[model samples]
Target: MATHSSVAHANLTVRQTLLHQLFGDHHGWLFERLRARLGCPSDAADMASETFVQVVALDDPHSIREPRALLTTIAKRLMYASWRRRDLERAYLDALANEPEQFAPSAEQQVMAVEALIEIDRLLDGLSSRARAAFLYSQLDGMTYADIARELGVSAPRVHQYVVQGLRACFEART
Candidate 1:
């Protein structure tokens, strides 16, 4: 009487032997047909071996509609895999070719932009509340001076003065 472990071992051995037999018996026929279609021995052998391995692992290998039909399906799948790989390679090469070269900002430009921002912020902070709001509406929000005047219920001249004062103060701080 064999133990459960021994029975499982036997079943595995039997499956391996069946796989080897299937490969030996059908490999030549499968390879020849694939080679004729693919025009490459290495690819043909690989596809044919893969097909047998798939077929043997099936619960009912003998239930296949036709052996040649199954082999043809496997061959087509292999060709599709090769074409997909080629497509991915081409896309990668195209992306690499079209990418722009990377560069860091120049030190002078970085310093100038940062200094300008700081000066503008400082000037805005020093502004009277109403004047700062009017100036911010014109410069940052792109409102016209007349629009800022309407929103603040002030004269357009006052709005213009606020914007000019803010700009002058910013320039003075920067210098």
Candidate 2:
């Protein structure tokens, strides 16, 4: 008399069991490998746990033939994300420090702004450097295509194309 919810719960339990076993078997090895490369034990451990989380989200984690390779790839991506977030935070704090005291954003607003900037960075990730620059100039600085072209040393048409491409990238990312 198992309901559909019960069946789904059972299936999820099985998947969790398999993932837990995998973690139990290789977590130490993965942690040590990350530690050696990153030179920080705590960071390595965090990445290793995040790696397992990523794998568990995969549609077919059991199908991986080279678990270590898969683990390494996931952990590396997590490490990169951590680095990006830290670098972005540092830049944001520096900018805040330089702002006029009366015009400064509140602490909560600063946190929200940093988070928004991080998301914007993620949304723009696949663009060429120039395209990203063009988009940022147009959107953030309210620059015209002609002005962006002059600044970037490109043709106005080229700048427009970059802006269009960047818009498309953002649209695709959103949908």
Each model's Cα RMSD: 22.9, 2.7
Error of 2 at 74 (Å): 0.9
Candidate models: Cα lDDT each: 0.75, 0.89
State the lDDT of candidate 1 residue by residue for 35-115, as single tens digits.
998899998888887787678768855455566777678768767766655554565446545756454345575456445
lDDT of 2 at 174: 83
lDDT of 2: 0.89
Indicate the TM-score of model 1: 0.46
- Top candidate, metric lDDT: 2
Candidate 1 runs further than 4 Å off: 56-66, 100-175
